[model samples]
Target: MTTTAPTATAHRSGRRFETARQVADAVLFEGYVLYPYRASAAKNRMRWQFGVLVPPAWAPAQGEHSLQRTEVLMEPRGAATLSLELRFLHAQRRTVQEAHADGTFTDTPALHLPDRVLVPWDEGTEERVELRVAVPELTEKEIVLPFNRPAREDTEPVLDDHGRTVGRLVRRTEEAEGVVRLHAEELEGPYRVLKLTAVVENTSPWTPDGPGTAREEALPRSLVAAHLLLGLTPGSFLSMTDPPEWARSAVAGCANLHTWPVLAGEDGRADVVLSSPIILEDHPAIAPESAGAMYDATEIDEILALRTAALTDEEKREARGTDPRAAAVVDLAETLPPEVLERLHGAVRSLRAGTGAAAAPQEPAPEALFTPDTPWWDPAGSAPAQPTPDRVLVDGTPVGPGSRVTLRPGLRRTDAQDLFLQGRTARVEEVLHDVDGGVHLAVTVEGDPGADIRREQGRFLYFQPDEVTATEEP
Candidate 1:
C-alpha cells in the first residue's frame, strides 16, 4: 500500500513562500488596480476591473457575470485530493478629507468619498463559498467552504517621508477554501481534464448608496479582487491554459506536460516565500501576460531606453544620486551611442538600391585566434573548441545565415530551453561555432511564446543541426 505524505512536504524539492509579498507582486499585475493603492488613478477609476463578479442583474448589463470558469489538465496516479485557497481584496467606501487647488482642505460632507477604496473589515464576518469541478466522465459536483474575514488587528498604518498618514497596509487575505477528492476508479487512465468553477455570492451586509445620497457613488453590494491557489495530492500534477511567457519553454518541452498558472521571476527562479500550502512537483505553468518581456525589460539595452525615456535632463542627473538602478540604466544607454534613426533611413535607401538586399557584416576582430581562444584567460590545460565556417548544409537542405527552417518535435537541450513549437518555422539568422569546432545554428522562431535572455537581446535561439528541418522558399 502507498501512503500519502502531507501535501506541503511531499515535494521536498518544490518551492515555498511564507508571505504573500511575492504573490501580490504577481497577482496585482496589469490593471488589477491603479497606483497610490487608491481608487483615483486615472487607470483605476473603474473598480473590480479584472477577476471580479458583480450581481447577476448588474453583471449582464455591464458585460460581466457572477461566475468564472477555467479548465485544468490533471494527471492522477491514484486516489487524490485537489484543494484550493482563494484570496481577494475587499474594499469599502468612506468619507475622506481632500485639499482643493485653492489650498483649502475640507471634509466632502458625505459618508462616501470619491476616488477612495478603503479596507474596512468587520474582523468577525464569515463568508460561505462554493467550489465545483466537472469532467466529461463524471457528474458536476460542489464543495462548500466557509471563509473568514481577514485578520486586521495588527495592520500598521502607512506614512510618507513627511510623517503624513497616507493609508494602512493590508495584506492579501484568504477569503475561502475547498477540497475535491478523486478516486482511481473514476479515472479513465493517467490523464483527465477537469473544468473547475469557483463561485462566490455577495454576502456582505453593507449596502452601497447611489447618487443623490450623501455618499453619491453607486457601488456594488460587494466588490472583491479574486484569486485562486490549487493544491494537488502527491503524485498528481495540473496544467492550465494561458501560461506565463517565461514558462513557455518548460511547457513546450513535453507533449504530455502538466501546467498550473503560477508566477515566477524572469531568472526562472520560483518564488520561495511559501505563500501557498500546496507544493507542486513541477514548476507551475505561467499565464501568458504575466511578467512580459517588454514590461519587465530584463535586457540592459532595453532597460536603459525604458528607464531614461521619461526622465527630464535634471531628473536624469539626479537619478544618479537618488536611484542606483535608474542611474545604471542611464549609464548603459550612453555607451550604446548607436545611430538607430540613421540605420532606419539607411534601410530605406538600400531598399531602393535592390530587393532582398541587406547591409554588409561588420569586420571581424583585428586579431583572429587559431582555436577561437582570446588571451582573456583560457583555463589552463583545457582543450580549445574548434570553430566552424560561416555556413553549412543541414539535413540535405542548405541552412545557412538568412535561411529558414522548422524545429523538429521533442528537441530539447535543457528543461528550460526554448522548444520551437513543433513544425513551426523560424529564420536562420546566424551560424555559430563553439571552441570544440561544434556547429550550432542560431535561429529565431517566428511567434515563439517563450521568453529568455536571448529574446530580450533580440538574439537568436541556438540549436543543434539535428533539431531543425531546412525549408524551401515560401
Candidate 2:
C-alpha cells in the first residue's frame, strides 16, 4: 500500500511490516516463547503462555484485567470497513467434589480453584464471541451487543459415588454476538490512528434465587488468546512487530520503542506497536547457571525419540494413566533410554560462558529486536539475584528479574508513555521494592540490552507488579 502523505520530515515510521504476512511471521516465530512453549512442562520442560488474556475475576490478584485497547496508525483506503476476527477460550466454573469408592462425602465441594486444572472442570471451549468496537478517535462509539437474557432455572444434583442426593449445581446464561462498524468520516487525519477497545462483560446469567447455600451468583467468562487479526482494506494494514531501522541506528535511541508514531521510513510510512496488557516479568523458576539451560536442547527431538526407543509393556500402561493432554509426552519419557537421557545431560552450555564481565557488549543480529544476557530457560537469564513478593503469577509463576515477560498492548506508565509493544518478550534486570513495600521490576529487551534503559531515567525501565508476567520466556 502506498501513501501520498509527504515525507518532508525524515522520521521513524512505526511501520515494521508492510503486510499481515510479516506480522504472522514474527509472532509465530520459533523461540518467540521457548522451545517447549506449549509442552505440559510437568517434569522437565518449558510451558509458555505469552498471549493469554483472562477475565478480571479469574485473573491473579495482582494481574491486569482482560480489558484491552490497541492504537494503530492506518491509512484506510477511502472509508473501508475494518473487520476484526477475535479468537479465545471460554472458562466455565464447576463445583468439584472428591470422589471415593464408598460414594461418601469427601468434605464440602470447593467453590473456586487457584490453577486451571482441566481434570476437575469441563473441557474448555474455544469461542469467537463478538463485542462492540469502541474507538475514542472515531466520531461515534457504543456497544453493539447489550446484556439481555430472560431469567431461567436449571439445576443438577452434585452426586456421590453411591448415587445419593447431594448439593445442586445451578446456572443461567444468555449469549449474543455482532459486529461494530466505522466509516471513513469517523476516522480522522491522513494518518489515522484508531483506538480499538473491547469490553467483555459477564454474559452468563446469575444463580437462581432460592433457598439452600449451594447458590452461585457469578457466571462463567472467557479468556482471549494473544493472536488477533484485524481485517482492513485488502493490503492496507502494515506490521509493527519489530523496531524501525531509524530507531535501531542509535544504541540509546532503540529504547524509544515505548514511544509511538515511530517514523518507520522516509516514505511517510509509520507504525504504532501495541503492547500486551499482561506482564510476564518475574524471576526464573529454574536456578541461574543450572545445567538445564546449558545443554544443547536442539537435540530434544532426537533425545525424546531415543528415550522412547524401547517402551516396556508395563511402562506403556503407566503412560496411558497420565492426563490425556500429556499422555504422549509421558509415553516418550517413560520409555526413553536411561543411557540416552543421562548422556544428553549437561551437553549444553551458556551462550555467554566465555565472555568476561568487562567484555565489550556485542551487537545484536541484523534481524534481532530485543537481546538478553542469556537464553530464556537459563537460570541466569530468568532468575533474579534478589527476590520480591509473589503477587502477579502467570501460568502459576511469579514475576522476577532475569525472567522473560510479555507486555499488554497499549500499556502505559504513570506519565502515559508506551510501556512496550504487546506480544513480545523482554528480560527482567532487577526487582524494585518501594518504601511502601510495593514490588516493581526493571527489565530490558530479550537480547538487546541497549533497549533496556528508560529514556526518562537514563537507566533500566521499571514496570508495575502486574504490568508483566514470567509466562513468556525469552
Candidate 3:
C-alpha cells in the first residue's frame, strides 16, 4: 500500500500522513436553540434537532421537540458564580485521527475528546461573557466537558501544561465549598489499537442545530473571568467489570486520571461522566454572591455593578473598557479562581515550584470565525449582479432592481415605500440600491429606542454593497 504525505498546516510537524489517508468519517455535532440560523444568534435558544427522541407523545407534531435539560447541582466556595448552558451537541464515537501522528510515528499529541457534547449559544444575540472577582475567593465556573479513550502507545511519559503526562482536568466535587478536585483526565489520547470493545458512554440534554435564544445583554465591564467550568459530585464511582489494560505509561492531558480509576474497590472506582472536555470560556459572570436555590436576577445585576466598579480605572482608556455594556475580566492575584487559589494554594505552590506563569498566558488560539462574535446576516452582496447600466433597454423593457433603489436589511425589492422590519438585533439590516441594481448605502443610526426614530433599523445605514458592519456589538 502506497502511503502519501501531508502538508505543513495539517502536519503541525508531528505527522507525515496524507490528507486523503487522514480522510475518514467525520461526525460533526453542533447545538442550537429557538432563534433564526442567523450569524449573530446566542447559543441556548430552545431549538429542536432530529435523531434525538422527541416522542410524538411529547409533542403534537412529527418533529422532535426542544431537547430536555436539567439544572445540575453545583457547589463552589465563597463568592462563586455559575452559568449553566444546555448541552448543544454530544457524540459517543467518531472516526478520528489515527493513533500515531503518521506511519512513521509511534504516538499522537495525547489529545482526547469528550463523550458528551455541550454547545450553548447560537450565532445571533450580541451575547458576550466575562469572569470577574473582587473578594478573596472569586470562582467563576464556565462549561463542563467529559472525555474518555482507550489507550494506545505511550511516551517517555512526557509532561504537559497542567503537569504530569496524563492530561487531567481539575474541578470541584465536594458539597462543601472551597474544594477543587481532579474529576477526570485524558490519560488516554486516541487509540491505535482498540480492543474493538472500548465504549464511550453518552447521555442527554441534546439541543438542535437551528435557532437559539434571543435578546442577550452583552456582559457589563469590570468583570473578572474564570475559565474552569466543570462540576463533579464527589464520591462518584467508576465500575469496570473487565476493562482493558493500559498499553504503556499513556498520558496526555492530566497525569492523574485513569480510565479504570481504581483497581482495589469491591465494586470499581469513582469517576465523572462527561460529554466533552469541560471548557471555561465564554460563560456569563455576574455580581458576587453565594450559591443559592436559584440564580437571583438582583444578584446578577449586583455582580454586573461590582464588575463595573472594578473597571472604573480602565474604562475611560479603552473603547470596550469604556463601553458600559461591554464585559471585562480582572487579572488580579491568582490566575486560577480564588477558591482554587486557596484550596490548591498549598498544592499549587508545589505545582509552580519548578514552573513560572508560562502556562497562565498560553498562546492565544486562532480567533474562531462563524461564532456569535460575527455579524448575524453577512451577505454575499458585495459584487452583486451589475444591472444593465441606466434607463437603457434590457430587451427594451425598463428592468433592473431599480435606479437609486434602497435595498434595506429585511426590505426586499418588493416595491417602493415599503420597509422590511425583519432586522433582528443591530440596525441596518438591508440597503438602498441605485437604478442599476447597485447598493449605495445602509441605515446606521437606528434600533435603539432613543433619539433616532427616523433612523430605523435598516433605513439610512447604507454602503457600496461592501460596508456590511451592521448590528455589530463589539
Candidate 4:
C-alpha cells in the first residue's frame, strides 16, 4: 500500500530506464506464397528504442520481461532477417496491495515511471500505424522484416451492412507502439544517429476507473518520457524456439503486443510525423499508407516548469474521490503550455484531421471504406473470413484463409501451406483474372521440401516479374 517511487535525490532513477534494442529487421520466406506487410514510412524504423513505462536500455528485474517486435517486409521487396530493437515495457497489472489498501479502484493500475513515453492519448493523436525499411549508408544493404508483428486486440468490429458482425476493426489501440525515425535524406555512408519515437495511446475513454485523475494525466506525461528511453511493440516471432528454419528468428524483446519503428526528433522540441496503414476486412489484402506530419513538441519545459515545477512528485500520490484519475488530468493541465492546451482544446478537430479521408464513418462500417472490390489484410480465403467473388488469398499456406497455419514449415501438413506458418515465400507464376475482373496468382513451388526452404526464404520473398521486371532479379 506504499508508493514504490525512487527518492527525490534519486529522481534520475525514478523511471529506472533500460535496454534500447537495436537490430536489423530482415525477413525470408520458404515456399512460393507471397509474404504480407505494409510498406511505407513506419517500416523503415530499424531502431525501435522506446517504451510506455521503461526508458531505453533499462534492465529487467531479474526476469525476462522486455518490449519487442517481430518483422517481415512482404511487398516491394523481400529480406532475410527481422532485426530490430527490444526493451521491456510494463506487463500485467501487479498486485500493489498498498495502492488498493482502501479499496478505491476496481483494479490497482501499475505506474509506468519511465523518464518519458509517447502518450499520444488525446483524441486523434493515435491516428496511424505504418512499416518501412531504410538501410543506413553504414550497411548499404537492403533490410527486410519477416515474421508477423503480432496484431493487437484493440479496434473492434462495427456493424456490417445489415448491422451484423461486419469486418473486424480496431480503433486507436492502446496496444500500438510503432517506429518513427528522424528520416535522413541522404542514402549511403556515415549514417545519421536516428531518434526513433514510438507512440502509445489509451483507446479506452478517460473514465473515473483505471488510471484515475492525477495518475491518469501523469501516464501520458510518462509516455512522453517513455518514448525517449524505449519503444514497446511486441515483435513477430518471439517464439521460444525459431519457427521451422523457414521463419526468420524474430527480433527479441516484448512478446505480447505487435509493432515497432524508427523514431526521431526530440531534444525536447522536435517535429513529429505519425503514420500507419489501413487494414481492411479481416483479410489483409491491401496496404495503403497514411501519414500526418506536424511541427509539435512539449512547450519549452521551462514554461510549464514555473507552474508545475512543484508537482513532479505526484506520480505516487494516492487516488482519492470517486474519480482519482481526474486529478492527474488536472495536474497535467496545470503544467501544460498553450500549444498542448490547444491540442487539448481542439482534440476533436485534430482527430478528424488525423484520420485520413478513408476513415469510415462511426456508424455502419462502409463496404466502400476500402476498395469495395479489394481483398483485406489477410487476403482471400483466410480464416475469420472468406474469399469473395473475384478475390483470393496467398499466404505461406496452401490457398486457404483463417487457418492457424504456421509458415515455419519443415514439417508435413495435409493443411495448405497458406494456412500455417508465420512467414512464407511464393512467386506469382501467372496472373489469373476471372471475367469479373478479380485478381489471382497461379503460383508454383517445389512440393514438401520446398515448403521448408520456402519458410526461411519467405521473409525475403518478393515478386520479381510484376510487369517490366516480371522476370528480373539482381
lDDT of each: 0.40, 0.37, 0.24, 0.25
Model 3 TM-score, 2 decimals = 0.18
- 10 residues in a row with least lDDT, candidate 4: 25-34
Count of backbone clashes for each model?
18, 58, 80, 141
**Whose lDDT is higher: candidate 2's or candidate 4's?**
2
List ranges where model 3 is wrong by over 4 Å.
1-273, 276-362, 365-405, 408-474
Global fold similarity of model 1 (TM-score): 0.37
* TM-score for each candidate, following the candidate numbering: 0.37, 0.34, 0.18, 0.18
Choose 2 or 3, whichever is better by lDDT: 2
TM-score of 2: 0.34
Report the C-alpha lDDT of model 4 over 1-474, residue by residue, as the tens digit: 111112101122111111111111010000101101111113211112233332222213222112333222111112211112222222111122112335333322222222211111121121212233332321342222111122233433323246643223222223223232221122222321222222333222223323223332323222221222222122121122222232233213213232432221221111211111111111111111111111112233233333333434432132111112223433454555655443322111111211334455432222233332433343343356443432234332233211222133323334463344324434443444554655544333324456455555553222212211122222
Kindly list the per-residue Cα lDDT of model 2 for residues 236-338, writing each as its tens digit: 4333334334322221221111112122211222322223322211111222222222122344544544444454543433333222323455444545566
Higher-scoring candidate on lDDT, 3 or 4 = 4
- lDDT sort, best first: 1, 2, 4, 3
All-Cα superposition RMSD per candidate:
17.2, 20.0, 26.3, 24.1
Tell me the spans in candidate 1 whose CA falls farther than 4 Å from its real position. 1-24, 33-41, 76-79, 98-141, 148-185, 190-223, 238-474
Candidate 1 per-residue lDDT, tens place, 1-474, comes to 121223312222223222333443334332333222223334334544444444344443445544443233344335544544444444333333444556444543221212222333111121222232222212233333434353232334434466655544332332222222322223233234333333344333333243233211213333344444444443233333334454344334423111124432222332211112222223333332222211121223234354454555544453342222334544544443445312222111111112222323332321222222324333663477455577788878777987888877453555444442567888787788775668888887776565355556867767788888888877
**Order of candidate numbers by TM-score, starting with the best:** 1, 2, 3, 4
